[model samples]
Target chain A: MGTRQRIVVAGGSLAGHSAVTELVGLVPEAEIVWVTGEPHKTYSKPALSKEFMQARNELAELTLPDVAGDRPRGLRILRGRSCVSLDASGRAVTLDDGERIDFDQLLVATGAAARMPGMLRGVDGVFPLRTLDDAVAIRARLADRPKVAVVGGGLIGCELAASVRAFGLDVTIVERLDTLLDRPFGGALGSYFLDLHRANGVELVMGAMVERVALEEGRVAGVHLADGTEIAAGLVLVGAGSEPCTQWLDGSGLQVGDGVLCDAHLATSSPGIFAAGDVARWTNPIYGLRMRVEHWTNASAQGRAAARNMVALATGRQDLRKAFADVPYFWSDQYGQKIQMVGWHEGHDRVELDRSGDVPGPLARFYRNGRLIAAAGVNAPRVVMRLRRQIEDEARAAEAA
Target chain B: MKIIVDRQRCDGNGVCMGIAPEVFDVDDDLYLHVAETIPEDPELRARVRQSITSCPILALKLVEE
Candidate 1:
């Protein structure tokens, strides 16, 4: 081969780490440098709200084992350092310390960061549950045994409330939505969500806005709702949501939308540049829709797919590059219940909900224009997974047609 | 390669089953069942290894012979 290609991978989380693992196997002669601003790189993020927060998983157990592959000989890792900027045309990456890394190809898997409101910032006993460190800090606060208030009723918020309640502590959820995850099934599962959380002893304030956090001694003492309801909480956790880490690509001449805008092939606007993970909002070929999935499974699979395409480009084998198409799947564990959804549930005109006695749990199938597009099941694995495959076949058939 | 699953930590998330369904399967009871014998296929073997590590809970461990 010609002089070995140099690849710079930004972000050391799941997406970036998974990409490096595959690149090492595909191009052993390539010099790869991975950069991240966090120290506990490669930890399982899903556990942060579940097992880790519940104390079922130890800190050491959160570390992920190296995926089945040989270690890269031409690889270097820079921890606690982040890539602050990128020059897409020049193929240069600037680290936080002002160090510049030149490369032939660049993978922008920088991932996402927590989206916290300004009102919740700089307050003691207020934590955003996004990273391992966030989980650690929350867990340490659990020793004090304070009343908890969770902001948001989305996946992370509900999951966090469930975990905190597992300790038999008092926790309340303040959600702006009328029901939790209404977009998932258009409020079909609203009662089910309320039932599960209420039975688990969680206080839910739906259709409520947080006016402010009442603090005592600069620490959270209570939360004030806009409707004039006050929630007394000693510790407050915000599961609001996350924003993609794309500020570094600002003015870098790369197309940036809610995330790095990519085509179906996961290629960015610039040549020799690609992006994956939560930081990528690409056209999903499976649904013919543009989406950015910030879940564990999508990041893992996208990382591998992007790396494969990057290798095909680096080797000048344009024909070998393949478009990344996937049926997004995510599962949440709350109060010992396994809730899973596979496929996109957006813009479905019709929903076929099955709560029959035959099924293990409530199942809902979403269809757009008479074509099956998504499925969701609670505590049902085999049937749901079967529907997952059926969804792939049907969605792909529809996509082809 | 022999696979060992820590039952306590395994919540049967089916991440492994999603990757290589031929080697791993999760039933409706939220139980993960691994195949008794792994087929002698290189591509399948690599995917099996990925399935092991891809397990979000790190419940699966591989013991090589």
Candidate 2:
């Protein structure tokens, strides 16, 4: 037949792997190349925060199942090699080792990098939990039960703190925000996490900035807060946040805001090039805004959707292309409780908590213009599931209307 | 179809319970328990298979009898 289409996918996280899996299923004849910066195969990134800390056992425990066994015949995986630059017009990418790989279609799923505060750079006994190596190093460091200071009250920081505390280590969460998880769950639900952590014996330092990481003999001794308070610690974990890995595409003429901009179909500004996962800021028709979601479920769903769209555009079956419109869902496990959230409620005007009288579990629903936009719950999996289905049904009805 | 759960692999994430509440249950202690051994109904079988596929930890498996 005609020349085989070459598809190059950057990044080897869940999103990139999912895209490759989808492409192999959609177009078996196409040649696929997966370029990953890490040497290891795709593993569960979320497990690094959830399970890895508790048990420092084999890496296989956290590894992702072998989805590559069913890959297409012409698949090539380049591990430990990162895409350094992109040439959209020529449909080519330059790797870090000075090798150029050409592609008929490209998918950028570079994901994101952990945001480390400037003061903690190059300090000993300080780590940012992102990759497999980071997890292993942190686990090794915990063997001594050293006092640990977590420099954020977000999901990762809270989870890490709780897991470390389970090991009986003295842990303190230093947060700049007034309440934990406020950005996602707002004040009411954020307080729930606050109480959870407090009950678990994890100390919380609220609304205080870490002025600098105190160093002792080139190693971390503690942290000095902006309010002139010093907290003693032997180990520090920075989980401030993460930034989209889009530095490689700086010179490329793609629309780059906080992430590579894409339309509702997850297609980038340049034709035949698309982005997904945390690296893509795409228009969500359901939310009526451009957003970049870093949740695992959203990444997997977006990867598949982007792959389908890429296949349609490349094979000239544009009519078969579908819009990427999956509800964002993510769950965080901390202190034997499952905190789950579905959909977005960032701009919601009101929130209502439906709690069974004096019961431990409560379902919080966010409403925007009298419409249910999102729902979050603590230890309420069944209610969250029903609410998710209800939100999806409403969206479908709205679309039909 | 018979559903099997590897207790060693299950993280008690409750994803399966959300996907197939009838077949899977996650208690307050975060212990995931299978409500039925064999899904006699076709709809329940489909949901069990869906939960097996959706489980992030791959703790659930379907075995053909």
Query: Candidate 2 chain B — worst ten consecutive residues by lDDT sum?
Result: B46-55
**Model 1, CA-based lDDT:** 0.87
Candidate 1 clashes between residue pairs 3 or more apart in a chain or in different chains = none
A1-401: candidate 1 lDDT, tens digit per residue: 24879998898888887888888888888998888679765889999999999999897898886533435588888888999999888889999889998999999999999999999988898899888889989999998999999998988899999999999999999999989866644565777889999999998899999989998987899899999999999999998889999999999999998999999989999988999999999999888889999888889889888999999988976855888888888899999999888888888899888998688888889888988888888988888888888888987787677
lDDT of 2: 0.84
Candidate 1 Cα errors over 4 Å, as ranges: A66-71, A184-186, A317-320
CAPRI grade, predicted model 2: acceptable
List A-chain TM-scores for all predictions: 0.97, 0.96
Per-residue lDDT tens digits of candidate 2, residues A217-319? 8889999999999999999998888999999998888889999999999999999999999999999888778999987767767887899899999887886
Instruction: Encode model 1's per-residue lDDT on B1-65: one tens digit a residue.
Output: 78899999999898888788898888888988998888889889888877876778889998877
